[model samples]
Every structure is written in C-alpha cells, then in structure tokens.
Target: MRFFWSTLSAIFVKDIVTELRSRQVLPTMIVLGMLIVWVLRMASEAILTSKAVMGPVALWISFLFSGLLVQERSFAAEQQHDCIYGLLLAPIDQGTIYLSKLLANTAMLCIFEIIIVPVVLVAFRLGPDTRWPALAGVLLLGNIGISSVGTLFSAVVRVSRARSSLLSVLVLVVLMPMMIPATFALLTVFGAVPETLQGTGALSFIGSFNAAVGYMIAFDAVFVVACWLLFGFAIKE
Candidate 1:
C-alpha cells in the first residue's frame, strides 16, 4: 500500500512539475475560460434584463471546453519526450498510474476553477451576495466528476489521431446528462434560483449541498476505479 501511494505521489509530482515548466495547460485554461466568458457576456449585453441563467451556464460552458482541451494536452505533454513511456516501464501499478493522472488533472482543474470562478462571479455580477466558500466547495465537487472522467477518457483516447474530436464527443455525451444535476446544483448553491429540495428525486442541492457533493464524489469514484482497473488494457491497445 505504501509503495502504491509513493509511486502515485511520484507520478503526480512529475506531472505537476512538467506542467509548470511547460506552462502550457494552465495558460490555455485561463485564456480560453476568460475569452469564452467575455465573449458570452458581450454577446448578451444587448439584452437589458436579467442574465441570471446565462451566467452559470456560460461559466460551465467555458469550464467544459477548456477542461476538454486541457485533458487532451495533459497526454500530449507526456508525448513530448515519451515521458509516459518511462512511467509505463516503471514497476508502478496500473491503478496507481491512473490515480496519479486523476489527481494531477484534478489539481489542474482546481487551479483553473480558482481563476475562472472569480471571473465568472464578476462577469455575472454575482460577487457581493455570494458565499465564496460554499461556491468553491460546490465547484470542486463538480470538477472532481469532470476531471476524473475526463482524465480517464483522455487516457483511453491518448494516442488517437483524431483525439480531440473523439474525446469531445465521448466526454460531452457522457457528461451532458450530468449537467442537469450540476447546473441545478450550482444554481441552488449560488442562490441564482430558488431552492430545489422539494423534488429532485432524492438528491437535493437546495436542502443538502453535502448530498450533491457526495453524489458527485461517488460518481467520480466509480469511474476512477473502473478506469484504474481498465487502464492497463488501454495502454496495451
């Protein structure tokens, strides 16, 4: 167990250091997120009334697009010097490798959210009355589901020639259903809309944010474990 964890930490550090040196994914995530929000805001400027719904929707759209690109870039970065090859040759468990990648992706996504969340709040005029800590917690849960699944799909389609398109299709297809719960959860958490606890099929972001967070955590955990178990086959293919 200690060896597995140690190996996971080493790979996680390797990825983080490599990303910092390259300065690739973070910049793109920041840039893309900002550009998308700004553009969307500008586009909606003509509408005089509320941007109430558009705000969170726009924020998530930016997150989804930027996240997809960054996930692809995560593996692409490994291709630069065949770094993944070296990792593969190491006596690390395949599950450890998957977990390391998931953790690294989650870290990157969290940083991206840190930058993007403020932009989102300011752009949507949601700053003053908002609960920063609660918002952060909600976003973290949502991103866990996103990055965990994305990291797995990114690995699955790592070496494909048409990786971007394929990954975008697959990730969006799988995750779009999640957006209903996520959007409502965000809306509820942000207090953009009224509470939805009355009837949300058991999980209620309105009355219980923890339930929503736990739901996403469960979602991520299931996928992460599945990917960790299947990653060796993915590598071989």
Candidate 2:
C-alpha cells in the first residue's frame, strides 16, 4: 500500500514538474478554454439574457474542448526520448501510473475551471445567488469522470499515429453517458431546469439536483475502477 502511494506521488510530482518547466499543456488549455468561452459568449449574444441556460452550457463546452488537449498531451512528454519505455520498465504498477496521470490531469482541469468558471459567471451574469457549493460538487465529479476515462484511453491511444484526434473521439464518445447527467446537474445547480421536469413522476427525479450528482458519483467510481483495472493491458506495447 505504501509502495503504491509512493510510486503514485513520485510519478504525479514528475508530471507536475515537467509541465511547470515546459509550460506546455496548461497554457494551451487555458488559452483555448478562454477563447472558447469568449466565442460562445459572442455567438450567443442574443440569448445572453438566459444566464441560467447559457452559463452552464458555455462553461462545459469550454471544459470539454480544452480538457481534450490535456488528455492528448498526457503522454506526450513520455513519448519524447523514449521516456515511456523507461517508465514501463521501472518497478511501478501500471495502475499506479494511471492514477498518477489521472490526478495530474484532474489538477490541471480544476485549475482551468477555477479561472474559467468565474469568467463564465461574469460573462453570463449568473449572480451571487448561485449555489456555489453544489456547483463545485458537480464540477468535481465531472472532472473525475472526464479525467479517469480520458487518462485510460490516452494510454490506449498513446502509440497510435492519429493519437490526438483519436483520443478526442474516444474520450467524447465514452464520456457521453457521464456528460449528460453532469450537464443536467450543472443546470440544476444553476437553477435552470425547465418546469416540465419539475412535476411528480418517475421522470421527476431528473429535476432533483442530488440525483444527477449521485449518478455522477456512480459514474466516476465505476469508470475509475474499471480503467484502473484495464490500464495495464491498455499500455502494453
């Protein structure tokens, strides 16, 4: 157990340090995310009055696009100078590698969100009455869902010729299930659910913010465990 944690921390730290030195992944993600937010805000100017609807949509669209870059670059440093081979050869569990990478990616995305979320709220005019704690919870679960699956598939496509494009497609397709509930949860947090879904019925739970959050928790758990289990095989050369 100690060994597992130590290895995970060492690899996680290495990734953080590498990105800090290179200034590669995070900068691109932030710039692309900000640009995306700006473009969406501009394009949807007519609907800007609907902050409840547009704010969450814009925030997530920015996250999805910018987060793709993070996954695409997850193994880029390792691919250089055959460093991936060295990591694979070392006395480290592949699951450890996956966890470390997942943590690093989540950290980066969270930082991205910290910057972009405020800008989104301001641009969309989502006022101080917003349910910040609930929004934060939804974002954290969404991040885990994205980072877990993305990190796994990033390794799966690490050696492919069209890795960047392939990673984007795979992550998006696999994440659809999680993304829907997450987006709904975000809308619920922003108090944006339509009146139709609020009435009593089997479908009414969809309007319950906690239900969506619970679904995200389950999605994150299932994917993280499944990905951790399959990562060793996925990384095989």
Candidate 3:
C-alpha cells in the first residue's frame, strides 16, 4: 500500500516537474485559449452584442479543444522517449499509471481554467452577478470528466500513428453529456438565462444546472472506475 501511494506521488511529481521545465502543454493551452477568447471577443462585439449568450459557447469551444491538446500530448511525450514502457516494466499496476495520468491532466486543466476562466469572465463582461464559486465548481467537475475518459482513451490509442484523431473521437462522444450541461449551467450562472429556462432554445439544451452537476459527478466517477479496471488491456502491447 505504501509503495503504491509513493509510486503514484512520484509519477505525478515527475509529470509536473517535466512540464514546468519544458513548458510544453500549459503554454500551448494558454496561447490557444487566449486566441479563442480573443476571437470570441471580436465575434461577440461584431456579431452578437449580447455578452451573456455567446460567452458560454465560446468558453466551451476553448475548453474542449485545449483539453484535447493536453490529452493528445500527455502520453505521446512518454512514448516519444519510450518512458511509458519503462514505467510499465516496473512493479506498478496499470491502474496506478492511469490514475497518475488522470491526476496530472486534471491538475493541468484546473490550472488552465484558473488562468483562462478569468480572461473569459472579463471578455464576456460577466459582472458581479456571476457566481465565481459555482463557475469554478463546474470547471473542476468538467476537468474530472475530461481526465477520466481521456486517460483511458489516450492509452488505448497511444501506439497508433493517428492517436490524436482516434482519441478525439472517443473523448468527445463520452464527454458530450457532461460538457454540454456544464457549459449550459456555466452560461446560466453567468446570467445567460433564468433557472426556469435552463436548457431552452438558442441555448444548447442538456438539462438543469444542479441536475447536470450531479449527473456529471456521477458520470465522471463511473468512468474513472471503469477506466481503472480497463486500462490494463489498453496498456499491454
């Protein structure tokens, strides 16, 4: 038990230190995210003057693609130097490796959100009425959803030359339920519409915010457990 926890910590720390030193994943995420935010800002002013409505959609677009960027490269880095195979040669279980990847990806996404969400808030002119705490909560859940499924699918396609494409499809399909609601709820909390009209027209309908939050938490949890069980098959040569 002690060894498992320690190994997990080491793996997580390794990813953090390497990323910090190299400045790969997060830089791309921030630059690309900023670009998306800027484009959205221009579009909002030029096309739709309504800040509330467009903010949510634009935010989702940024979040989804930026996350894809993270996941695609997460394992590719390992495979590049054949480091993942070295890790596999060790005594650690595949589940632990999966969790490490999941944790690292989730942590990176949280950090990205910390930086990007504020930019998003300012860009959309979301004022004092915006529920910062609630919005942060949603972003946290959304990260978990992305990381849970992403880790498994990343491992599944890690050996493929077209890994980026394959992982994108698997992730988007599994994640659609959670991301759609999280987006709508985020927009709602930012004053896109009243609670009564949570998923109405002109709004990408999923369901109520509270309900969406509850479901996504469960949804992510289930996938994490499934991935933990299934990752071994995905990892083997």
Candidate 4:
C-alpha cells in the first residue's frame, strides 16, 4: 500500500514539475478555451434574447477540446525521450501506470476548468447562480470517464504511425455514447428549460446517466489496465 501511494505520488509530482517547467499544456488550453468561449458568445449574441443555454454548452465544448489537448500530450511526453520504455522498465504494476497517468490528466482538466469556468461566466454573463455546483459535479464525473478511456486510447495511438489525428477520431467515436449523459447534465443545469427532480422520470434520466457512467468507470479502469499490460507486446523497441 505504501509503495503504491509513494510511487503514485512520485509520478504525479514528476508530471507536475515537468509540466510546469515546460509550461506548454496549461497556457495553450487556457487560451484556446478563452477563444472558444469568446467565439461562442459572439455568435450567440446575435441570436435571440435570454442567452442562457449557451453558457453550459460553451463550457462543455471548450472543456472537451481542452481535455483532448491534455490527453494528447499525456503519451507524447513519454514518447519524447523514450521515457515510456523507461517507465515500463520500472518496478511498478501496469495498473499503477494507468492510475498515475489518469491522475495527471484529471489534474490538468481541473486546472483548465478552474480557469475556463470563470472566463466563461464573465464572458457569457453566467453568474454563480443557477445550479453551478450541480453542473460542476456532472462535469467532474464525466471527465473522469473521459480521461480514463482517453488515457488508454492516447497511449495506444502513440505507438501507431497516424498519432494525433487518428487518436482524435477513434476517441471521439468511442465517446459518442457518453455524449447523452453529459449533454443532459449540462442542459439541465444551463438550458433555457431545466428539468426538475420531483416527478417520476424527471431527475431519473440524469440519475440513470450518472449511475451508468459510474459503473462504466470500473469497466474503463479495467480496460486501461488490460491495455497497459498489453501495450508493451504491441509496441516493441
């Protein structure tokens, strides 16, 4: 237990320090997120009154792209100096590698959210009101699912010749089923017409979505573990 915790901490710290030294990922994500929100706001401004729904959609869209940016780098960094092989040579379990990578990716996503959410609110006139906390919860949960599957796919694609574009297509295709829960949660929080938790199926949709995705996290975790165990066989020196 202690070894696992220490190893995880060491890897997490290494990633944080390396990312800070590089300073590429976070800044690019923030700038891109800002541009996305700004563009969306400008587009919606010319539309009808009560620009309420666009708020959540803008944030989610920005977050999705930002996440892809971070996930892309997850394996790209390891591929740089063949540090991936070094990590694989380390005396660690495959699951640990997956967890560490997932942690780093999740941390990056949270940082992007921290910066993007405020910019989104200021630019789109969404206050701290109107179910912001609930929206945040859903985002966190959904990102966990996203980052898990993404960590696996990113590593898989890193070994392939196609790399970035191929990874993007494959991950996006696999992520389609997740769009419903994510969109429903976002729409409920930021839509012009919000759903209530009172009726029989009122909140059930979101609840079911959450539960289903929550169970899938374990499945996703297992898949990542399997991939980590198998990737070495596929990608040789």
Better candidate number, 1 or 3, judged by TM-score: 3
Name the best candidate (by lDDT): 2
Question: Sorted by lDDT, highest first, which candidate order results?
Answer: 2, 3, 1, 4
Q: Let me know the TM-score candidate 1 reaches against the reference structure.
A: 0.88
Which ranges of candidate 4 are over 4 A from the true structure?
Answer: 128-130, 196-237
The list of candidate 1 runs beyond 4 A from truth reads 47-49, 128-130, 197-214
Ordering by TM-score: 2, 3, 1, 4
Off by over 4 Å in 2: 47-49, 128-130, 194-205
Estimated TM-score per prediction?
A: 0.88, 0.93, 0.92, 0.83
* Clashing residue pairs found in predicted model 2: none
**Native-structure RMSD, model 2:** 2.3
TM value for model 3: 0.92
Clash pairs for candidate 4: none
- Candidate 4, 57-112: lDDT as tens digits: 78778877788888888888899889988888998876777778888998889888
| Tens-digit per-residue lDDT, 185-219, candidate 3 | 77677777665453446443555667767777888
Kindly give the stretch of ten consecutive residues in candidate 2 with the minimal lDDT sum: 194-203
| TM-score winner between candidates 1 and 4 | 1
Model 2, residue 134: C-alpha shift (Å): 0.7
Clashing pairs in 3: none
Candidate 2's clash total is 0
The Cα RMSD in angstroms, rounded to one decimal, for candidate 3 relative to the true structure is 2.1
Name the better of 1 and 2 by TM-score. Answer: 2
